[model samples]
Target: MSDHHIVFIPAAPHYLPTEQQVSSAKAALWQWIPEAEAIEAAVTEYVQFHDCGSNFEYVRCHVCGQELTIPQWHLLMEQDYDLERGFGLTPQTLPCCGNVASVNQLDYSFMQGFSRFSLTAINPRTGAVSAQQTELLQRQLDHPLLVIYCHV
Candidate 1:
């Protein structure tokens, strides 16, 4: 069986939702991503989030325009980078072209990270929510949001 998760994180790493904000965020989630089930809000001191299993395939380097194979990308993900400490994937000298590259500079279609507050939707059958929907929700919640894809 395959499981999917759509996790919503704050756009800014330091942003934490208040109790009242959680309630409003939940409402916005329901309205925007109606297919989501068991929508919940969580506040974490530190969380290690990743897309261990998902549809993402390859990531292209922005510097050299070279694509990193799955194994190559997996190697990068395996590195011990602490998200709680505000440390994310660091830029590395690419083997393909010897240019400095980071996850942000890679062109791929999923999100991953740790944050203080996460608004989650479990097993959303419709796949990812649209950007327009997220934008509207962000405006309503008064917080920029990051949508992440995860499978466990």
Candidate 2:
């Protein structure tokens, strides 16, 4: 469906910070997550080169109570896939099928990432993101959909 047009950038590759860095950030930053576990959650995000800040905002759905604003999720499978596991891993499939006949699925070819992008709704309950949330990544990053299908 047209609602799944927005392309959200997933968390970056796995990178762990040293205890010193974490402690230093905690001392300097205002909202430092205090606990190590809480700090790790935000550290391993799929931030993109385009995104300015580190923190991402997401709201929960009032109806189904599912996440609908994922800044980025992982595509489990890929031709250049690796075995090493990380934090926010996901299947290498698009959120098509089911009741909605999405055009961004295997049936239709992506027009070099051009088209339209609708902003995703935030889910408040759980910190999960949905496919409906998307914003045009960039004109230069356009492709035939298959290349970076679920990477963003």
Candidate 3:
């Protein structure tokens, strides 16, 4: 069987909300996804990738909009990662456009990203979140948000 996840991450990769804020966001998430099997928040010491799993399609350059091959992206990922420290998110010159950007800056087909913090809903009753509902959660966290849908 496949597992589905709704992962909410801050727009800034390193941003960590206060405990009270996280609690508020949790409450709001429960209200929004009442039937979810579980909802949890995490603050990690190192950056973690929030990926779309089987839903991932492609990655595109933000500047040139050219498709990036898997190998190209893998090389970049390797350049940015560390065994003890995780991703540094350093900017690199793109092969296609020569534009400098981090992996987090690229356009993902399924909203993948790197983050040190995340709030996740596991197997929610609903798959989609409305813009208004997202806005409400963002307000609770007091930060801009990126919502990722992952299927595994």
User: Which 10-residue window of candidate 2 scores lowest in summed lDDT?
Assistant: 111-120
RMSD of 3: 0.8
lDDT per residue for candidate 1 within 75-100, as digits (tens), equals: 76556356545336467767678887
Residues 32-113 of candidate 3 have per-residue lDDT tens digits of: 8899999989999999889999999999999999999999999988998999999999999888899999999999989999
Q: Model 3, which residues run further than 4 Å from truth?
A: none
Number of the predicted model whose lDDT against the real structure is largest: 3
- State the lDDT of candidate 2 residue by residue for 57-148, as single tens digits: 33233233344334311221232233443222332333321232111212212211112221122121223222222122211123111112
TM-score for each of the candidates? 0.70, 0.23, 0.97
What is the lDDT for 17 in model 2?
42
Error of 3 at 18 (Å): 0.4
Candidate 1: pairs in clash = none
State residue 135's C-alpha deviation in candidate 1, in Å.
Answer: 1.1
TM-score of 1: 0.70
Better of 1 and 2 by lDDT: 1
